[model samples]
Target: MNTLVTGRRLARELGEWRSTGPAYRALADRIRVLLMDGRLASGTRIPAERELSGALGLSRTTVAAAYSKLRDDGYLASVRGSGSTLVLPGLERGDHAPGSGLPLDFTKAVTLAYPGVAAAYAAAIEQLPAYLAHDGFDMVGMPDLREAIAQSYRNRGLPTSAEQIMVTTGAQHALNLVTRSLYSPGERVLVEQPTYPHALDTFASVGARMLSFPVSQDGGWDLSEAQLQLRRAAPSMAFLMPDFHNPTGTSMTIPEREFLTAAATREGTVLIADETTALLDIDRGALPPLACFSPGVITLGSLGKIAWGGLRIGWIRASRDVLARILRNRPAQDLGTPLLEQLAATSLVRELPVLAASRSRDLKLRRDMLVQLLGEQLPEWDVAVPDGGLSLWINTGTMSTSALALAARSEGLGLVPGPRFGLDGAFERFLRLPFGHDVEQLRDAVKVLGRISSRVGPDPLRMPLQAVI
Candidate 1:
């Protein structure tokens, strides 16, 4: 018996229904469920896009997109000859946890797309139908979009080129591409302790000799000290989030960036400046890209935080030579980003004001609301009012964030403890809570946390919040 339904099954079930989403996702998700449960055996060919789209009265592009997501995740494989086949290959714990159904998903350091973006995406689709006759894999990107991104960088006082850009699936993909191309497994990689969780995770998975440098809540970094650590650890490469650094929401000065880039350059190390969170800054001025200070740096940027995480779009700005290296590394890990998402992101980038204004209003409100709520409800917790970014780094008096996290998870709250962001459990006394959620949800969450915090004794709360900055 056939397990996962082919597109033919969806055609039969929907029977020329023209509705979008709800119905669209139902068909896609049902197939995913079957594949996950081992019902969808490998080597089964899904129906052709034209056939299914016509049969269900759905746009071919929509079906194509669902297929694209599955393709990206390694769930389905397609080639010029073989058609798509079922292949949910990974066996991982996080995969089993599933998507969030709650009003608040603090774990996401990303913004939800604006309501009007649907129209913008639809516009891209309308535009795509016209372009279908041409070669789709224009690897560098749509030229207009490249020029737009280059302009954005220029606006921020950093010089860039369309040639320096390569559109990617997201910041994660961009970093991974750079990492794979720039350094080999077992290479020494230096990272900020209490850094973006995925960076450490990525470095470690590559079997790199990973070293963690300190970053502070009150003190960002002292150059001389960091230089010593760099000399001592002798890392082959480093990943940085210089602008509005993740989880901690710290921003580096131009001087600091210059010093860091110089130090890394002198040490003969490649600096991967993950600028994924750069533009969300509510701060007063522009902080130029670390690449401005050193030509030898790889910088990652994305539409995720600026436009929406659903865009699944990011880019790497590096020299033309490094771009070639990243291209050679691409096929081993990913083919390339889905063409549709890239198109949508490109449109979104051109409409920069809409995206920036939406981000500014939403994030500013959410950030302010969170600060007030935490102050009112969890007065005992010492939380930093960040300069920018979606999350607040808390100096949780207690070192055992695991206890609070476990306690919170029981109440349907996902707490990303500082240790998850740290290499040596050094941020044991720190905790990260995203201000990305709305006021009501943040209020409720703080109440839940405050209730949990109330029960802990003074001793557990008195431990010095370690600064692994």
Candidate 2:
């Protein structure tokens, strides 16, 4: 079914879209950015030109021209008696394949596969035949794999049992399952303002109303605003990344974690902690998992980032009751996590410490290289060097990264603009540059940024106060 974007909704998404260019072209460019960044999905029907014009208080001619430009660029399709629908040109709708036809794709914040992955898979293959006679649909997880996942939690100081684990295809799948089981339609879901973009996608898929608190690069999580939202909104669920938060690599201090968990518990809200990036630690020492504070907090873990993105294995660590609920709802989405991957994951989980150490050494070198390159080449841009996580969250000062991304794409580089991590088109001046790629690629990406910095004009967009914590 095709989704319809209302005029009011489009206006909210097009926050501060105007720039120092023709209004129509600027509007079209902003829409393209939204589409490319996966905020505004492909194949959705947009509001009519007249409706959008009234929503933005612009002339109908301007809206018409914007729509015309989108059609010209093959980003939209129009049919008589039907509205204009967004299209992605050559790619299928909702396709998230790795390659973007760009030479340098910094859109993903993933790292190279852990070196031992092939050996683990080989070990799994030798062990796979032992279970060929049984039904292949393993709903919960293989017993050994679940135990391995539980042991990982125990190593982190959060006592866990195999019964508390339910493996999924990946962390994203685990999140989807949790959201479906926990979130009620129309109930509010609280989130970090600039969170994992796909987490927002999952929440939006359920049509859940969202509230957000800030996680700034300098000041850390805004607990005051978080408490206010929990107390005021009483949202049904709150999504968080306490350890090595995406975009901004700031982890929550122990006090902040304690307070937030206590606050959510008081408000009767379900706290879901995404720990996909937790194990990607480069230098920052271990912090207690959020689950350590509250048994009710649901924790999601995956090997995708720590091992390889190709290894589709992740598990949810929750109370037995929560696991039971998730298990009951699991089959509707997928029958089971692949048995072969689980066998491989069991071995990988056992060797997590070794993998983490290896990733740390490599990540530190690349992170330092990218930081030095950016500092030397684009000194005007403010960059916060994160101790861990795959990317650097940069403040482009006055340059509009949406424009920067559009310009960079033409130069054979693909970048994700700051607004992709934010809601209501916030963070236009910020950019996320992943340091997980090769040193030469990082150097080249920075060079591209430096070269185009002058051409991408300044944007006056500010974070909307209502969306901020």
TM-score leader: 2
TM-score of the candidate numbered 1? 0.77
How do all models score by TM-score?
Answer: 0.77, 0.96
What tens-digit string does per-residue lDDT give for candidate 2 at 365-404? 9999999999999888888989899999988777778888
Give stretches of model 2 more than 4 Å off.
Answer: 93-99, 460-469
List per-prediction Cα lDDT, in the order shown. Answer: 0.71, 0.89
RMSD of 1: 15.1
lDDT of 2 at 432: 88
Location of the lowest summed lDDT over 10 successive residues in candidate 2: 460-469
